[model samples]
Target: MASSSKWTASDIPAQSGRIAIVTGANTGLGLATAKALAGHGAHVVLAVRDTEKGKRAADEITAEHPDATVTLQSLDLGSLRSVRAAAEALKAEFPRIDLLINNAGVMYPPKQTTEDGFELAFGTNHLGHFALTGLLLENLLPVPGSRVVTVSSVGHRIQAAIHFDDLQWERSYSRVGAYGQSKLANLLFTYELQRRLDAAETIAVAAHPGLSNTELMRHLHLPSAFNPLIGLVAQSPAMGALPTLRAATDPGVRGGQYYGPGGLGETRGYPKLVGSSSQSHDLDLARRLWTVSEELTGVTFPVG
Candidate 1:
């Protein structure tokens, strides 16, 4: 891998003895990430809400790389019970984990609530990953070079702020605003988690897939007049998965760092180290959000 060259899925190093668990690996960025990792010899676990789709994805990976090792583990981040069950199942299967990718998330959807009663986007995107990471910390602690990579989004730049007053949007709700809040929380969580895990070999990092053409945009409706313009700019899911792959496998990557596209406005292109919004770096806010998250999820990290 060239230091200055554009990073691609091929840039991922060998993972002959490694194990990785990727959330929402049924399709989109998660599937791309899992396939790339498995192609390099890693035993990839697709932690998906739908077992049938997950198995199909595993089969696809195996079909591409006959030597690939993959498995399916059921995980529904929106519900705490499901998160706990998935963690226990993973703990029983693997004593050590090399990578845990929080790639599963819900985008702009009609106002709704998760099974846990939290706002759909915030509950599934941030809190779900938060609880899952804390619950699975033990499996990662003993594995040197292990990483927890959370997938945020460039949409986070739009009205992204932690609404401490109404964390669940009990009073009012906006699909776009809630999505932004969730993505922003991903960065704060990564930064704060990295701080808490400073003494450990494992690290926490964040990445965004840029504007990818994936099913995540199912709820994103635009006027017919703007559809073509958006299509002309959005990149394929494989291209969008670059930043995440880099964050997960790049040897030089540090804890708390963010990765995204290097092209204009970070809309598309190869993966590179990128800067996050100033709001995303607020330490005070990160700490407070971390505390609130712990209380809401009832899952505590061993690092702290």
Candidate 2:
């Protein structure tokens, strides 16, 4: 709770007996976040699309911390059916969940759609997590100090808008614009969810990794010329995962707060409480998006 400017994995308090579900835990920032949590004595479920990769990631975590409890749950965020199945399995297995980290996401990939026909970025990044959180929220509602930590991105400030008229981007699409929309939706979802949970023990918070060197950048398609510059400026997955770790584990974190890098432009540094774009704070927009998300995913929060 002290100045987060110096916050790191070492600052994470003991997480013994906690149950954490981290999406996309197979690699990059997700892997780092999961490993750190497990190392801190939390039982972590690596909810991923690839069982093989999840197993490997779990193995890696246990190898580093022999006492770590790591499990795998098959999840494909692009498909609503998959999300529901994963949520059901999780609910049946764990009566309580302390943390739900919506960490998995797709970046600037070529225009495509998910199994549910929503834009890949928007569907996987926003709608998928929206439904999953709603479905699993019941497990957390009764547990005091429970939290839902959503991973957003600095890109949310770039070319981002609700685009209600063309939410699917069927008429036209710009990969950057679509990605930004999804990240911005993340904040909207968190703020609105927090409002709904005002009287509950559960809380909603959001964080961004800044410019981290991770697989998410595979689709960035930045010219080879920028590789050197990017490599120099981008932080490691461990560092990038700090904001998320702080958001999820920091006792001082409050509902609706956003965390990001502490350096200039919030490009790279240690985790800190960061400000979001003005549009992301639009209460009306958040409410509207929440309604549309429920309609699209057919998953309603119990808080509502």
Candidate 3:
């Protein structure tokens, strides 16, 4: 892949007739990524948790580019029912999905459980997207030149590895630790999926938003008030979206590639190919996590 350190939104290639699904597209970096894809003439599906927000986001993007075909669909990554419904709907309507951006995520939140009784941050951040991706693999696998781009964070480096004994943090819960584990799972999932896809010769890649300022910090704000400091110094959502956008559209990119900013501490800058933590690239754990995720979500992928 070419050096994308100097690349900007204008460098994105035209995507006319392309179909893309972006989870959490109602706001922040996900919205920015969706807008970028639509700007290139892709049929953008804004998979959001809230229908009202999804519609509004779609309208806002279409307003900017009247010809930027956009659609709003409900997707609550915290719930398995929601993931299944969204995937089934996507399959029924769209014959192919050229790109799938697993861009939505949640940051640190006070200890709590999701609708499925798993830790909120881990459940939503990792398991939800994990199940969603597996459910939609059938449509994605056969699509010519299709790719699955997952959005991760530098927080992945914040945690060492998954705590198998207390995977749900039942013994004790540290918000930062749980968040790190989830983000790390994103990378693991990405790499694992890529390995599986490669074995099946399908496309799968991963990316990180670095330390961009986005609504993912909404939870981190109320409970701990840590977001203010991050916001004051963090990159804007558009800047954060660059890494994801680069991973999705850059022709030079390849499966299993990891992208991030080229700035100080990789916290912010233009998107470029980057490295990931060794744990994130661990094939054994990735495979274990995949099996665990399938059993938990009741979603089996045909690809593997």
Expressed as tens digits, the lDDT of each residue in 76-145 for candidate 2 is 9999999999999999999999999999999998999999999999999999999999999999999998
Per-residue alpha-carbon lDDT of candidate 1 for residues 122-191, written as tens digits (9 for 90 to 100): 9999999999999999999999999999999997889889999998999999898999999999999999
User: How does each model score on TM-score?
Assistant: 0.98, 0.99, 0.94
Candidate 3 stretches greater than 4 Å from native: 1-3, 199-201, 222-232
Give the lDDT of residue 233 in candidate 1.
Answer: 91
Model 3 TM-score is 0.94
Model 2 poorest ten-residue lDDT run: 1-10
Q: In model 2, which regions exceed 4 Å deviation?
A: 1-3
C-alpha local distance difference test of each model: 0.94, 0.96, 0.85
Give model 1's clash tally. Answer: 0
lDDT of 3 at 71: 92
Order the numbered candidates by TM-score, best leading.
Answer: 2, 1, 3
